[model samples]
Structure formats: C-alpha cells, structure tokens
Target: MREVSSDCRVAWFLGLAGLIPFVAGGVIAWWGSSAWQVTAVYGFSYYSAVILSFLGGVHWGSALQVPRPDNRRRLFIAMVPSLIAWPALLFNVVTGLWVLLAGFILIGGYDLSRDGREGFPAWYFKLRGLLTGVVVAFHLIVLLRLGG
Candidate 1:
C-alpha cells in the first residue's frame, strides 16, 4: 500500500470519530438500561438523519466544484437525501428508523456505484464505504433492539 498523507490520516481519524455516536446509540439500545433505550433510539435516529443530510450536502459541494448548466441533475440528486431524511423524521419511531435506513442505503449505494468516478478522491470513497457499513450495522442493531 502507498503511504497515506497527513490529510488522509486526519480524514480517517475524524471519519471514525463520527461513528462514535452510532456505536454508542446501538450499544445502549441493545444493552443499556431500559430507561435509556428510548433515548438511545431517538438519538440514533436523529444522528442518522443528520448524517444523511450531510451526505447530500457533500454532493452539493461536489456539484458546485464544477458548476455548469447540466450539473443541475447532480444538484437535484443532492437534495434527495435531505428529502428522505425529513420524511423519515416525521414517521413513527420504527418507520422513521426504516426511512433513515433506506436513505443511508440509497445514498451509500449511489456513492459506491460511482467508484470515485464522480470526482472525489479514491480514499474518500473507501472511507465512505467503511463508514456507511458501520452506520448501517448500527441501524440494524437499533432496529432489532426495538423488535422491528
């Protein structure tokens, strides 16, 4: 493997750091006190929505990186995640979780399918894959905890 630059090292650190809440929320849902379970789920759901929205913004940023009249499609795609997230928040706890889960899968799948061809660095797609996997896993854990 090639030596990763300091920038990559920092990105890796911060990206992994972002997973802390997901891990905590899932663990707490599965094993924390009963009193904390509800709170854990809510926190996890909210955080997931935020992350989903953030993913959309990343696309927006990328689209702006090379602005053009034809980039409107990309910009429209960018808004889809936030649209999904908002409705997910409106649904019941279980349904909302499902919506957010779908949102992650949708966006993550779309990103991965591009295989860094969308102008992002290869390392970014790799990091996104790892982070998305962890995020989805925690979503499953929380859902199962809720008996969904």
Candidate 2:
C-alpha cells in the first residue's frame, strides 16, 4: 500500500471531525424527542469543538509549506482564530460559527493572496476556500433552522 500524504491524512482527519457534529446533530434532531439537553450540551458542543480544533490543525500543518521560520510563524499566528473559535463554539453555536467564519475569511484571504506564488499549491488554496464556503453555508442553514 502506498503511504498517505500528510496533507491528505490531515484533510481526512479534519473531514471526519466535521462529520461528527453533522451526524450527532442529525441523530439528536431526529430521534431524541424531548429537546435532549444532554445531547446538545455534551455531544454537540464537544463534537463541534473537536472538529474546529482539528480543522485548525489542518491549517497549521499546511503552513509548514512556507519554508522560512518567520513566514511559518506568521502563518501559525493566522491560525489562532481556529484555536479560539472552537471552544467558543462549544458554548454558543452562533458566536462560534461567527468566529469560524472570521477564521475562514482570514484563511481564504491568505490562500487567495498566495495563489500562484512559489511556496503553496494553487489548487490546495482553492480547495480550502471551497470547503470553507460549504461549511459556512451549512452552518447558516443550521442556525436558521435552529433559530440561533
């Protein structure tokens, strides 16, 4: 078997992390009849945080492509939004989603700005932007439905 690329591995992990909330939320919303406070507080919140944090790790891992220590440091600094947003999301989905949106904005901006540059692959940035857009849309739909 071929060894998996680190980036691919990271992406897969992040994707799996994201799916946890989607699945848990769907299950709770479907089967659990009585509002399911425990599911919301424990399951949803915890899964959201884990997903956000893993997504941040994906960004941090990708930043390794920037060779210079200073550049990598700057990229890491840019990743801080992911770190902050995850835990906040655990408390409040609206606020957390907003924070994540901000992080996605910053990351997307960085990706767009760096496109065609020597260090980063253009497709990777494009893919990230697309994934972020999808996540943002999903979050919006969820919020609207939940009235959050």
Which candidate achieves the best lDDT against the true structure? Answer: 1
Q: Which model scores highest in TM-score? A: 1
Worst 10-residue lDDT window, candidate 2 = 114-123
Clashes of 2: 0
Residue pairs in steric clash, candidate 1?
Answer: none
lDDT of 2 by residue, 1-148 (tens): 9775788668656754666565556456445665673355345445545555655565566567556645666566656656766567665656765565565566556556533233555445555666667655655555554566
How many clashing pairs per prediction, in order? 0, 0
Estimate every model's Cα lDDT from 0 to 1.
0.88, 0.57
True lDDT of residue 8, candidate 1: 89
Candidate 2 displacement at residue 1 in angstroms: 25
